[model samples]
Target: MSKSLLLLFVAVFCINCSSDNKESDTPPTEEPLYFPPLTGTTWKTKSVESLDWNKAAVQPLLDYLKLKNTKGFIILVNGQIVMENYFNGHDAATNWYWASAGKTLTSAMTGIAQQENLININNKVSQYIGTGWTSTPIDKENLITCKNLLTMTSGLNDATDDVTPSALTYTADAGTRWAYHNVYVKLQDVVAAASRQTWSAYFNTKLRDKIGMDGSWFASGNNSVYYSTTRSMARFGLLMYNKGKWNDDVILNESYFNEATNTSQNINLGYGYLWWLNGKASYHLPQSQASFQGSIIPTGPNDMFMALGKNDQKIYIVPSKKMVVIRMGEAADNVNLALSDFDKTLWTKISALYQ
Candidate 1:
């Protein structure tokens, strides 16, 4: 072997080795988010330090919530509890009302029912619930569909205080209007009739039992409301954070879950089927005719969508951060049935804590 030939061969080998080293040094991709299994009363947990969070900063956020009538609060990252708090004698065992936050649960169950081929959301409400479900005549009632109920676009006159069929009169075609009305209760009935089971029974079977959630739905006059422990609410937020999955089980359909959390109608960019979404150009507050000019929760994550309810029940999900936060308690501010200024203040405090 000549010296020149050997030197050239050595340089070629060196080049190949450098290329291989570069390929192996590329950074590994981040781990995909995961959820805990639905098993015993205890759920998996993670420390704030696991995410490099400043623990000292969390106390101010807690103190603020305590002063603002909050009873229960939980924040989960990657489906593990990072913070679970209760105030005013409310503890892990206390079951509280989800208020309109339960609307998100109903929407999920509706999606599951549709997934099971029980009833299509786009189908007319009269089809499953039978005719005369609404005060509207045959022609008008035919225009009102299950989707309308879900989207709060049923076009029924929400001006009336009474919830009867006659009081829930039709003033316009379905899908043409968005009003936060108690007429949403009819959706549960529609699901019930279509599934041949009561709303509570179906929900208990399809969702609660499947997710190890111990919650009960009870009648509150014209509405059916849900009551559950703060952890149960956190479990629900986790199920949604994983995009409708409970560990290995696919409890809610993926495609349906996406639509359920994103904007569902042109009228309200921050409202999905029944959930409240954040990071939209604008949003509408319940019982208000005006559409505000910003995300419902300005300080929360841009990707966070929420289940906000009357007198301040909340379930917040941030897919970008693999986070699910829940607030189940009394009113933080004198707001009606939707997002409030307190949402901004609390989230702003939380943002500081995570820094």
Candidate 2:
């Protein structure tokens, strides 16, 4: 070959190598999160094929949900709907009760109240509501802080749902015991007293309206339960999944959000500020003092946190997967206050979709 032709060939090979290097070095862009408008029925969605998820697993999961009497079920990925279904005479507009899953809502409201300087969670409950709130002796009663109520460490009786002063008798000194009780509802009273606004009023203005959720708290016997459309529950989960942010708005601060979703007390590693955490070493159940070993849901992602309610209403948030799952319905099998065998089995079905 001529010298000029040999030199020309070498130059072309180097240029080709350089081009390939540049292409490989560039990072892949992440998909942006989708946030639905604050006042609209329209919501964006992605299909199973687009996500490269197991399309074959979708029907089986839906079948199981219907068999177990699910009223509504939704799964979101990056704030977009991936799956949504309603069963047993329920529809998109049908409202269902959140049961104990609503406790997480109260937790978020308390955090907001603290951020607003209306109340400090560290302060004694009696400070806002005044003394004699509980029948416990003055010294013991003062030991109960707003944080205790959030953590279920109030050390109050869990036997009765009644929060009347007489029924809120002391089982042990506050902070030393962990028993789920209706006493957490008192935090609403504390917020109302401090903010000088009705609990529902404050909740509506600060949270519901901000996130475009439509829900109302109602008095059922001695409990205050929140009822809302399944999509509304998904919205709340999306906010929490974003670490208390809604698009451009900072709803709940990140500091409080981290504390609320992690271990809040020593007794139950799986229990947070009314949130049930997965992948904890151990956990305690409502009305039971014994500790159960292992993660709350073995098949669930380790990083997932949940708002689980009586009869299996749930809002599951998985940060690692950028996913939010909502389930609202009657008991899957047997009546349960919170965690049940259904959780493990349901997670197994959920895992099939992405695994």
| Highest-scoring model, TM-score | 2
For model 2 the local lDDT of residue 135 reads 89
Give the local distance difference test score of model 1. Answer: 0.86
Candidate 1 — number of clashing residue pairs?
Answer: 0
- What C-alpha lDDT do the candidate models reach, one value each? 0.86, 0.95
Using lDDT, give the best candidate's number: 2
lDDT of 2 by residue, 1-355 (tens): 9999999999999999999999999998999999899998999999999999999999999999999999999999999999999999999999999999999999999999999999999999999999998888999999999999999999888899899999999898889999988889999999999999999999999999999999799999878999999999999999999999999899999999999999998999999999999999999988799999999899999999999999999999999999999999998987676889899999999999999
- Candidate 1 lDDT trough over 10 residues, lowest sum: 31-40
Error of 2 at 204 (Å): 0.7
List where candidate 2 sits over 4 angstroms from the true fold: 1-6
Question: Which residue pairs show collisions in model 2?
Answer: none
